[model samples]
Target chain A: MITKHLSEVTTKFNPFSKQAKTCRIFLATLPANARQTMKINSKVLPRDTDAKSELKIKFKDGREMQFDPDKHSIKDVAEEVDRHSRVLNRQAELAGS
Target chain B: MSPRLGICRDCLRKIRSPSSSTKRYLAAAAAATATTPAAPPSFEAQPPPIARFPRTQPPSHKPPEFRKSQLHRQYTSLLRSTPLLLLFQHSNLKSQEWVSIRRELSIALSKVDETYPQTPPLADSTKLQIIQAGIFESALRIAEYYKPPPPPSPGDSLATPSSSPESTNATPDPSNPIFTHALSRHAHDAVYKFKNAHPLTPLLSGPLAVLTFPTVSPPHLKAALSILAPDKQAGFPAPTRRASPGYYDGAVQAGVAKMMLLGARVEGRVLDQGGVQWVGGLEGMEGLRAQLVALLGAAGANLVGILEGAGRSVWLTMEGRRGLLEEEEKKE
Candidate 1:
């Protein structure tokens, strides 16, 4: 349980990089069909690549977006994955009953 | 002479003209007088009419209804009568009888507010008294019905004749104390009732009493075992701390004993064990000694030995000083 919790904290802090940023931009700009394709491919990507950012682009249809790294804001690309992760975690907790 | 005659003619014409002109002038004056009356003098101006307002009647006060007054009276009467009713119910009633009595009492009390004339504001003290009376009455009735019969007369025992006056008076006073103290007394009565009435003695014997009178510490193991025993056992067996044997085992006991000793030494400093010694009375000494022993037992041998050694040293020193005093007195 503790390890799972720690991993979740680590996932939240996963660093933003140029590739993650580029993926975030691509996800924001991709059409819905293209975004879904990216999301489906997120699991096969490099561990260093921001999975959340990659997932966001995969899920949301191409929509232009901007976020400041200095602002510590959630990237548009990773938002969908973050949302899904929250939902899955909650579901898991409920299932444990 | 001709000039004089012309003058006379002119004078005659002038005279005729003067009368006619005078008549015309009088007629004109009459007509003017008829046309206009003398201007009426303006009297002092009348004051503007003052604005009038409609009159309003004062609000009327209505007396409380007869039924309200009657209910208030009944409430007061119930307060006085409830304790008496409870005493009656307690003496000779069964559980069913007591329940009926309680229901009747509730109905009677409720009727106080049912009618219009009897509505006196329920004063706080009166309300509290009523509630207290109700609880007391209910508990007393239950207790009386459920209480066990007195212990059976022993063989060869002389039966004393029962006195009615003393018992009757005594009963009321004893029950009154339970009501007077309210919560604490109620808790005491509840425990008493449970102990007397509960059918399962074995299951309840030790734990029920403790649970009922939570303020009371559980009886010592030796005392409890004796009270609960079916028969006396041979030899003074090591009294078990817990009911279940081997519950604590070696490790748990050792851990508990160590903790106990530590707690004692820490508490002892604040408690001032020396003061207990200074009192020197048997009770004071015994109490202090028991407490010290219990603490040592909890703390284990190491802590207990330290305290015991200190106690022995103090005792020897006191004894020596007493002996020296006695020897000096003998020589003198």
Candidate 2:
């Protein structure tokens, strides 16, 4: 597992740093190719051609989860991000203590 | 008779045609008729005037007829016999007395209405309504008349500690640490009682308590928290930051605004380490503050901003917390 600084992903999306823990979990759930392209800079990263368009994810907590554009018909990636937000929340709660 | 006899003698001397006696009688008749005019002119000139005796009338007594007066006296005596008026007189109430009286009256009237769901006829209903209205109005007037004395200021207490034991006991004295210590203990007792008797446990279960405590000073927060049993306190994580007055103020202000939005009044005491802080007389304030915290937490805003905007004292600790948290994370 490639471990990256959680701040790198959080700073990119959550400038407030209030949701740093949640952002980390969401980034970790992404495919390696997709996750590598996700940078903290304001500019959007280039899309990868070889990366699978969609993938199912098994969260660290053993929760059943899946994300697919065609078969599952998940249209909005932002919505998908929200769908997995609970994972990040649980993680944050644990880390907060 | 002599005249008549003379006439008769003359008549006899001149007895040639009519006798003298007849002429004398006719002359006498004419003289009598002349003496009394045809029907006295005064009698024909005016008709009789109407006779009017002095117009006397009896005096009128407006209040009551004798029968009614007797009945009223009887009723008054009956009313006097019972201690009804005496029981409810309350004539010599001081300023705060009406607060209790009004509350009692409201409770009594409410009970009456509740017990007698089927009211009497319109007349009786109207009478009761009027009486109730009068009672309410009078109670309100009495309450208005009796204004509570203004809160004694810190300086005022400092000046007159000798005069008032209660005030002296409440006023914190740097020189008398024991007094301050006792006050703090009393405040803790009050807080415990308040929390135990609090009516909004369901709403207060989580975010409410969290937001309320952080807004007050540390000592007050500790005292307030002490009221909650140890087990409950252990359930929630200890706040990362020391209690700061500004943060607590901000939280309270935010909480109040949220409550106001929900159509509730915010109530709670702001206490310091010295003990009982500011005691507000508002009711249902805890519930209101709890509701506000829940709403803000659900909405996901910086709870501090909303609190400050609501005109509560948000201590500098809130700002410091955010900054410190950010700095600590950056170092990592």
Candidate 3:
């Protein structure tokens, strides 16, 4: 999921909604110590609330992306992260610490 | 030895035709035997059924050796045993984090147990278990919906084997209707129609863990809530650093942050997060009993006052009329 490039993640989802499954799985797939490196804000909407599930991510290179969890599957979210992360990787390699 | 061809004369032709009278006698004997019923084979009655499988180990629908089958058995037992349990969604938490969290949770729970020395210590019995959600859901369905009739008692079957003969069969077949254990095909079929329709279905998904209590003790629940979720508005405040310095350890804090409270199942009823908080907000069962008693007592008092008021009003009216009549008589 290229978690190294992520700086912040904000998510809001109704746990009762089936469409929020992608959001839940994405959160679960984060590295165990990801909290140490990145900022994470997850809001669990109450059961009766009919709110839309949102997942927003900020990359290390200042690229921000927002995804509608209802419309996006976990694979789509992961692929999007990887695509952006690969460009960041190329730039870092050329710069060479 | 016979002289001709070295063969005995008796061996070559031994049979002699029976006379008519002899044939008639033989036929009469055969008729007599056929007319009478055969004698009892054995004096002793049928022995108790030779059990094919051990009573403790009933045949299971799936291969019992598989992990999922074992988990199914385990979850069914867990659901049946625990009347009060809280569900959680645990993110990627390191083993060290889980260890510290468990340690802190136990420390908090034991403190609650100390306050009520009269009650059995609940901290030891309460468990935090990470579960396979799909297997768990099926187990929950079986525990909730599958109500097979009680198996026939051995004594009952022994006495009335003639009427209910299948109960006496000593074979371990999965299709046998006599076995009604949770892993039986009957139980699976009973819960199959309502797949994912359970009220707790949504919560059952994702990486799930359960905090189970031996009994629905509100004090323990409150303590657990404080240690695990720790929302002050919910009335579950985290322990102060001075009070529980270990709770402030880095690993414990990290683990606590990763685990989210989903909902609870209390006494066979599914509850949302709010409902779980409401339950934790209660005092113990004794407190609930006291509240009921107080409510009923107040209602009884009100009822008595209403009845008395009606009688007193009638009496006052009659007395006033009598006095008026007496005063008029005096004037007359």
Candidate 4:
């Protein structure tokens, strides 16, 4: 793909060339159908990445950015309130599964 | 303006129309002078309005209803006329005649209760009193025929409730607060009444005659327990307490025992039956007192604590050492 884009027609390239590297210039274009497919793929990749970042969150201060995604999940406020919530949950457990 | 030499219309009207009150004063003063004829009635005498209006009593207490109240005022005299126990135990009272006597007694008791008003209490007190009276009868029957349990054999501890005929009678626990409470609706008032009548004699004398009074019942036991029981027994026995072994449990027996000690019913019975050592020609009264002090201690820490306090005060006067009352007085 690099060869087709840069239009390098060399049969062999230097293995140990000491020449200072310069920017390559593109001289060939993709076919119209390949170009359309490449555009669609670029859009799909960003949507998938954004969805992963959205799932990675911390909720300590109501809602917040979670630095360590593996660590925390709940939106806790205070230990006393948390304990009370647990007690209520246990009471509910008595009533049902 | 020469300081307004003329009176205003209001002043003029007040001055002229004071005639009704003025006539009343004149009439009073004239009567005073005309009747006495010793010294002239002072014209500067205060108005009759001051004498006419008596001081008003605070109505914190309910004013007794007419017949009910009249019966209440006469309650002490009524009890005197036909003593309470007499109403129950009159030898001449026929068995079938109980219906008429019950009706009459209920009427009188209802009237007496008008004086001893209770409000927002646990139960209908009249009903509780009837129930208490029934329990009292049961207790009295036991006391009448009670034989101290035969010497305990090896299997005594293994005896279950089902092992004895007594256990079969399993009455509901009479430790009910309602029954207890009905005993003392006017306890505070009764203290003042007794105090006024005979000073401290009544509290001190647990003599045979007084001990024979039918008043010492489960209700009194409940009151004694309230003042005596350890907090573990925790105030009186729980209100929902159910009795085992017919009439009462160990806790209740202990309560009744303490109650008897206070009234010296056991000691008096001992005197009547001749038991223990005698001193000062009193037929073992001291031994009985010591025994009772010990027995009351078994009921609760408070009674023992009181006995200890009295013991510490070697000079504790006769007047100061009212058996049960000393505890009540200390509580106050």
- Global CA lDDT of candidate 1, please? 0.31
Q: Which candidate is the best by DockQ?
A: 3
Which stretches of model 1 miss by more than 4 angstroms?
A1-90, A93-97, B1-245, B248-332
Residues B189-257, model 4: lDDT tens digits: 223333313211221221111212233222332322232221223234422334223113433332222
Residue B283: error of model 1 in Å? 8.7
Worst lDDT run of 10 residues, candidate 4 chain B, spans B271-280
TM of each candidate vs. truth: 0.12, 0.13, 0.75, 0.17
| Each candidate: chain B TM-score | 0.13, 0.14, 0.68, 0.19
Q: lDDT at B108 for candidate 4?
A: 34
Sorted into a CAPRI-style docking class, model 2 comes out as: incorrect
Once superposed on the true structure, which residue ranges of model 2 sit more than 4 Å away at CA?
A1-97, B1-183, B199-332
Model 1 residue B277 CA deviation (Å) reads 21
> For each model, chain A TM-score?
0.29, 0.30, 0.96, 0.21
Q: What is the lDDT of residue B213 in candidate 2?
A: 17
TM-score of 1: 0.12
Q: Is candidate 3 or candidate 4 better by lDDT?
A: 3
Name the fnat for model 1. 0.00
Interface RMSD of each: 36.8, 27.1, 1.1, 58.8
Docking class of 3: medium
Residue pairs clashing in model 3 are none
**Predicted model with the maximum TM-score:** 3
Candidate 3 lDDT, B158-249, residue by residue in tens: 67544332334343333334466889776887789988888888777889999999898888899999999998997989999999999999
Which ranges of candidate 4 are over 4 A from the true structure? A1-97, B1-78, B81-244, B254-332
